[model samples]
Structure formats: structure tokens, C-alpha cells
Target: MEFVERRSGISLWRQIADQIRIAISNGEFDESGALPGELALARRFEVNRHTVRSAIASLAREGVLRVEQGRGTFIARHTKLQYPIGRRTRFSAGLAGQIKSRGGFLKSHVTEAATGHVSRALELEPGAPVLRLERVSSADGVPVSRGISWFDAERFPDFANRYESRKSITAVLNSYDIEDYVRISTRISAHHADPATLDDLKLSPGAITLRTEAVNAEVAGRRLEYSHTFFAADRIELDIDHQAGTALP
Candidate 1:
């Protein structure tokens, strides 16, 4: 028997939907490739039949389950994409073989004075200027991650404009004559997706996200970029590569 947390700040139906999606991914229903009837699911989760119906409807909208009028809710072909994180992690390269199509676009940008955390991450004076960029990345036309990144405004003053044409972070950095950089440090955590991330990633309420905070630096050890990325946990898995060597302090 499964239980729903009434005080988890998540709607009961949403929790049910998220769990059903995970069970599908785990092949719990492979024998039938279809979900048990609403009444059975309600009994299993200790929810009302209406709640089970709502959960199934949400999964159907996400393309995770297909409902046949007379048959049942069947699993869709959705599968998690594997993404690798290493010293030289590149979004496009990481998803190359897992997906046929991949792309990312800048969602918004601003120039601002660096705050405490940003300044420390970028190794800059407290009030140094920085360019902040928000972006969303997709694989096979489905959003997989959303990221917020900061770069030294003094060095990449036209970073946003350059990225508009380059469409690739590597290419934009190349335009600045900085041919190489590497991951300096990375920290990861997991949490329930925030409302904004839920909408951006097309995730249902109560969905989980894998969060990564990282810093990148030039070969000479000058800080280049600092970013926070939120990946839809059900859609992608993070594979950390220890071969990247110890990151600098």
C-alpha cells in the first residue's frame, strides 16, 4: 500500500500522478503495459476514485500514459535520457547519443552588480558587474533543464547578444577569444520543482528536480562562469564522472 502526505504542501492527486509515473518508468506494469483500473489504483493509494482519475488524466497530458476509451491507461514510449557531468561537461555533447535532436535558447538576460555569492563564485569584487542569463534546454523537443548563469560583464559585455547569434555557449566563448575553460567545482542536490521550473520543464506539480551548482574557469584558473541548473528528474539522470579530477578550491 502507498500513502500520500496530506501535509506535504502538494496536492494529493499530483502526488499520485508523480508516483504512477515513477512506477511506469520502473516497469512495474510491464506485464500489462497498462494501469490497473481507477478503483484499484484508488484502493492502492488509499485515495478516492476521482483522485485516481485526475492523476491518470495528468499523466496522459504529459504523454507518459495513453488512455484507450475501452481498454486502459497504457505506458507511453517515454524513457529517461542519460546526461553526463564531468570536468568538461557540454550540454549538446552530453545528450548526443541519447536524443536525436537537442537545443537550448536564452529565455532572459540582465546586467547587474555581483552579489555576495555571485562575487565569490566568480572571484570578483563585491560590486563587479555580471551578466545574468536564463536558459532552457530541450531534448527531442521536450524541455529537460532550465539554468541560470552569470558571467563577468566586464569581459563579456555583449554576452547575451553574442549568444543570440551563436546559440551555443562554447561558440559564444570562442567569440571572446577564450578557447578553453573547464568545470572548477560542482555541487548537486534534489528537491521538489518550484512553480517556475515546473512550467518551464512541463512537469506536473510535485515533480522532482536534480539541481546542480557549478563554477567554470579558464585554463589559467580565472573564473569564467557560475551557474545553477535544474533538471527534470524523471526525464533525465545525471551521471557524474570522477575522472574529471579534484576541483580547485
Candidate 2:
């Protein structure tokens, strides 16, 4: 029996939706690529048909399912893209072979004083100037991640304009005479999507997100950028390479 706690305060439908998502990840629906009818789901979960319907509705809103009126509910054809995290991680390069189109564009940019978190990440004083960029990355035109990055404004006064003219961060850095940068560290976690990230990634309220806080520095060890990126949980899988310079397939 699927354990959905009756009096546990969590809504029944939400619990069921999570159960269905787990089952999907486990390939339970591979045979048909569609969910069983609501009646069947209700019986399997020991819930009323209405409760099952609500679960399916919620999953549909999260892009996990496609509810076809006359035919049947089907899983969305979203195979998770594998993203490699290594010393030389580049967003476009990581997903290049797996996707037909990949791009990241600036949604907004600002020059502001460093907050405590940003200051520490960029190795700057509390009130030091920084340039921040808000960006969205897409795979095959479907937005999959949102990122915020900070750079030392004094060092790269023209960073935003250079990045805007050239969509590639690597390219912009190259123009700044930075021949190479390496990922110093990357920290990853999963959480319920915050309101801003949810909107940026076009995800529903309860959707989960995989977040990474990464720092990059030049070969000689001068910090170049500190960034936080949120990837829609359903659409991407973060692959950590034990080998520093390993390439993804």
C-alpha cells in the first residue's frame, strides 16, 4: 500500500502527486508512456477517484503529464538532460551534443553593492561594487535553468555590455584577456522552487529545483565569477565527474 498519511497535515493530492512523480522516475510508466486511467490510479492508491484526479491535474500543471480529454493522460516527453560538473564546466559545452539548440540570455542586469553572500563569494569588501546578471538558459527552446552571477565591477567595468554583445560567457572572458578559468568549487542541493525561480523557469508552485552555487577563478587563482544556478528538477540531472577534466557524452 502506498503510505499517504491521512491526518499528517499534508494534502492528499499533493502526496499522491509526489508518489506518481517517483513512480515516473523509476520508469513504472515506460510501457505505455501514459498513466493508467484515474479509476485505476484511485484503486491502486486506495483513494477516491476525485483525489486521484486532483493529483493528475497538479502533475499536469507541473509539466509531468499531458491530460488528453478523449484519449488518456500521457507523460511529457522530457528526457532529463545530463549536465556535467567538472573543473572546466561550461553550460553550452556540457549540453551541446544532447540538444539541438542551447542558449542562455540575459533577462536583466544591474550594478550594485555586494551583499554579505556576494561579497564573500567574490572576495570583495561588504560595500564593494559588483555587477550582477540574471539569466535564463534554454535547451531546444524550453527554459531549463535560471542563474544569477556576480563579477567584480571594478575589474570588469564593461562585463555586462560585452556579455550582451556576445552570448557566450567564455567569449566575453576571452576578450578581457582571461585565457582560461576553472571551476574552483560547486555546491549542489535540491529544494522547493522559490517564487522568483519558479517564475523564471515556468514551473508550478510545488515543483522542485536543483540548485548549484559555483565559483570560478583564473589559472593563477584570481576569482572571476560567483554564480548560483537553479535547474528545473524534472528536466536536468547534475552529473559530478570524479575525474576533473572528464568530458560528457
CA lDDT, every model vs. true structure: 0.87, 0.88
Question: Clashing pairs in model 2?
Answer: none
Report the C-alpha lDDT of model 1 over 1-249, residue by residue, as the tens digit. 368888988888988987886787677875668788999888888889999888888777767789999997888766688888888899999888888898878899999999999999999999899999999999989999999999999999899999999888888999989999899898889988899898899976667899999998988999999999999887898988878763534
- Give stretches of model 1 more than 4 Å off: 246-249
Q: Give per-residue lDDT, candidate 2, residue 93.
A: 88
Best by the TM-score measure: 1
Candidate 1 C-alpha RMSD relative to the actual structure = 2.2
What digit string (tens of lDDT, one per residue) describes model 2 on residues 1-249? 276889978788878887888888888876778888989988887889999898888779878999999999999876799999999999888998999998778999999999998898888999899999999999998889999999999999999899999987899999998989998888898887899998888887667799999888998888899999999989999999878963222
Which residue window of length 10 is worst by lDDT in model 1? 240-249
Query: TM-scores across all candidates?
Result: 0.90, 0.87
